[model samples]
Target chain A: MRKLVFGVSAFAGLLLACTAHAQEITVGFVTSLSGPASSIGINYEKGMNAAYAYKDEVSGVKIKLIKLDDGSDPSQATKNARKLVEQDKVDVMIGTSSAPGTNAMMTIANELKVPFFAVSPVNVPIPADGHPWGVSMVQTPQLMVKVIADRMQRDGVKSVGFIGFSDSWGDLVYNGAKAAEANGGPKVLTNERYARTDTSVTAQALKVVAAKPEGFLNGGSATQAALPLLELRKLGFKGPFFGTPSLLNRDFVRIGGKAADGTQVSAGPVVVTSQLPNDHFAKKIGTAFHESFKKVNGGEADDGFSGYAFDGWVVFLEAAKVALTKAKPGTQEFRQALMDAIYANKNVAGTHAIYNFTPKSYFGVDERSLVVVKLADGKWVYQP
Target chain B: MNAQIAAILAIDGIASGAIYVLIAIGFVLIFAVTRIIFVPFGDITAFTALTLASLENKQMPGTVGMVAVLAVMATLMEVFSLWRKGALGKIPAALFFYLALPLIPAAIAWATAGTLLPTPLRLLLTVAVILPIAPLLNRIVYQPIADATVLLLLIVSVALHFAMSGLGLLFFGPEGVRTQSLVDFTTFIAGTPVSGQAMLILGSAIFFSFLLYLFFNFTLYGKALHATAINRTGARLMGIRPQQACTIAFLLGSVLAAVSGILIAPVNTIFYDSGFLIGLKSFVGAIIGGMVSFPVTAIGSMFVGILEGFAAFLSSPFKDVIVFSILIPVLLWRSYTLVHAEEEDEE
Candidate 1:
């Protein structure tokens, strides 16, 4: 009888142990794994994988990641978001490489009340009733483009020609420039636009040249961004060329070749992490991310898009840690607690920026997140 | 715009128009003979540009592998069809054309992929690598349904385009590539600085058009293709094989696309999906010609290019809208003038 009583006590103890250590948090990640946006989407996946490898758990709770591809379509992104929330029952959601897809996912996130972290600098509309569930990890186009506009003003440029994609991204950059002009930047001479897949921009380039602006501002991204620069240079427009952070990629330089030299652009500090000062806040975290990324991806991270994704993971982990103290994982209470924790986050150091979130503001970075860089000899050099 | 700006725009328009001309001719050739719209013609051009870029980078092109796989599939399909038809005697000839012909270039490309070759040799290799893709695609995708109506064939062609685009992303990542110019010099033409590359594009367009004209008017095989296009049953009754004519048409079409790709590679960034727009623009040109007259298609393509240039300058964001809108008027005119024939009547 004494032996039977001892066995019962041991079984109860084993059950208690299993209950104490079995918490798992599921994170649903959506990205464009195929289509035109796949180039940037693949980088986001790589960085997210690196971040997962760097920290597989938060506060002693194992993390689970479920990834989906949106094929760069906004409708597909919306469906993925819905599936992640309803079917996968994820605690938090992270996504998306393009603005349109992110915006589409944001609606679903809001409807479902799941906390979402967007890798793209997507604009979230001000809610009339409550705090938004979606937050952006990357700096807004206005904030990044302001740095360039300020530099243009400092350089005494009076007029500038603008060219960009005829999409939301282009509208954002152009509006950013216009806002900067209201605050003592160069006047934009012309607003020319092109599709991402256009084979030639000669007509647009010639028009920009005909305007004879003192400076040129290109708002396009990837290899296509190089088109205007090449055509402008060939047309003898020997003026200062400026760009937004979207032009920050190895493909842009490699395809642009010598024509990309002397081009100035604004970027996040993590883009030039190796050149950052030793005492900088982002340097240590950026170094960690780069190391982990190389280990995961088998090569160095060559673009800034990956750094944004890594920062998203860093921010998510910070919130998850606090949320774990409030409620158990995989519950409605826990998701609400995580959203509250993310909004309450303060001074969360990431590879790209030091994030500070609040109920009123979802884009948590400031001027400290941005830096000016110049393209020279097929590499980006930090510019003070 | 002043005269100098107008001149520059004209030069740019002509160079771009020359590229569309080659692609438009290819569209007309395949549609006339096979009744397939050949929506993936632009994908072939993109593959050629990508192949050339890979060669210049001293990397083994994905085309070699793609072509080899396609060749094997075509050969298997051909052999099976022939066997079912009790034409076992034709197996060797089928093997020679469907399997061996394509593998020869694939083998050469695989052998020299890692070593840098002369620019001319690299161009030749690039062309050779993509030569079998369209023909083999015909065998695999359309040969079995060769008697389908034009609308059905077009639906299949559209589906094939999407598949090719997906495959393109798999083979050549999403990044775009721009190759070095064939002739790296600029000369002033009537006070407008025209690059030698632009001249080469124009020269090649004229030369190929002339050569195609000569082929159609002089060569017996070319005449056979022409006869097949005009009346397939009539040509077959005269001992001409419509299938053989279809294969020959695809061959010639692929050559035009390959040459156009090489010429445009230096001028524009070529991505895995860039071909869709290029092909569509050329399709507009083809539609203007009623997909029948090569010379008229060439003229229509140049007009489209010039209009695109002016439209871009006037309102950049609406350039594509303007270019594509031309199709509506052209379609309306074609419908007003031409008699609609039923599919059964045509067959």
Candidate 2:
């Protein structure tokens, strides 16, 4: 009887010690840190780190962030997702810089029943039961295109040419522009495609220019998209150039230099936080994120990509706070509770926009979540 | 398409194709002398373009550091070789010409990095900075294994290509950079807008080709190079040093790469890895020339550019396929018509 009592007490004491340290929650981040999409992925990492550092602990639970590089490849992203879920046993997941990689991650998230928040714009068709498995921090292509269409209507653009990467992102942007045309928008004249690693687009540019569009819409992202714009200029083209949310970084401006001076970009509200009204919903947190991000990244302002990542972190934290009350971290119960809290949350203000996720829809924002900004004097000026 | 659009695209083709011609010229010269395919030729062009970009941005070019490291390494190897040959007295002159000459321009360029110098001087300085890389590379990489087989030399060339490309990534990052146009004027040619840069490309290609012809036909040094290319053993028996000929060819190749880079900088965005594709296209052009004739390579590359431009117009995505497919028929024609050399037939 004495030996049995001693063994029981020892077992109970060990369990108490393990529970104390195991109260920490782990979040996995997979993004393109070493390929063509690395610029956006690097900014995503910077923004997420700043947010996590700002909020070190959440509801008395320690948070651990595990970051992995996917090299802008879908296969690598899927592998990262599996490792995070099966081996690290992360309670929640967030990541990816490209749509294809994010789509690949969505499949894994659904299979593993882990809540994944994609920072890039992705349109994954979720079944009724798969709603809680995926949520996107990105504003949809339709939202960005709507903003572009509104601006084009204001600018009285009659015809427009489109050139983009030959991928899903390009298709989505083209479809969104076509949808906008149903509302009496500009006539889409030409659609051209180029690879991300292509060095020249003169042939495509010449064709687009020959079509005689009053304006051009570049459907690609970052510095690579700047190629078509430069080529257009070289071909003696004179027109306004509009870009998608993917061109919301300083690299595009820096690489394009004088040629990018008058280009307009449709982006999230946080891209022009300095110009946002004080009464705006996202103004306060957006400004704070900008200040914190600048302090961390050598005085460079937070871009649309950085804002999306920070917003994802904000949603993750809000859900985590609620889930902590239900179960301890590192348990299946905690994972289930976290996913439920995310879907149940309402009116959560992030740096980019208001998040109101529901069981029926995973994307939280709409057309109101975006704004059109023009590059002026090397800065993003809000076009209200 | 109308004649106007066709004329405009033909000008574009000639301008872009001039870059490939320059690259092919380098490959032909190096292969003729060294039996190496010279795969890193485009990498040198990218490096020069990025170096000019760094200069324009008022930042010291990363190439200065690279040159410094290479200079030190080449000097050490030369000194060691001299010591092994008991000719230590010659080390001072070798170090001065081989090491110090390269560093002088690098030092000057570094000193004048951010200053507003004349455009001519700045472009000249860019040329000077990249000129010594070839001879230095020859001394360090190829000279030690000069007697290696053709396959071994080709393997080394490819390895150098990868190394240089990776080094480009390390130095220039993945961002694509475009330098300011050397001349910023456009004029009409047959109702087609032809930029001054396009004119410069054509002018420079002609000038360089004419200059090479004169050098080979008129200069004793150039005739010596031709002799070396004809038969390395015979040239050595005739007391014309093979190493000296190889060094001159490498220098000429490097200069051509630098000039081509400067010419094309305004036309295309140069990323670190952009060279591989450009180099491969040039290689295909060189192969079409039987890897020997300069005029044949130049014409072949111009055809490539024209085919690419027209295909891109008809169907943009299939342009690469169209351009690469030309090589198959050319190779087949060569196989059917040409007699096999005895050494190659033995293999």
RMSD to native, candidate 2: 4.3
Q: What is the model-wide C-alpha lDDT for candidate 1? A: 0.90
Positional deviation of A300 in candidate 1, in angstroms? 2.7
Candidate 2 per-residue lDDT, tens place, B138-164, comes to 888999998887789889989998988
**In model 1 chain B, which range of ten residues has the least summed lDDT?**
B338-347
- Write down the C-alpha DockQ for each prediction: 0.71, 0.41
Best by lDDT: 1
lDDT of 1 by residue, B65-105 (tens): 88988999999999999999999999999999999999998
Candidate 2 has a TM-score of 0.87
Looking at model 2, residue B219 earns an lDDT score of 100
| Candidate 1 wrong stretches, greater than 4 Å | A1-13, A22-38, A52-90, A98-105, A123-129, A295-298, A320-331, B332-347
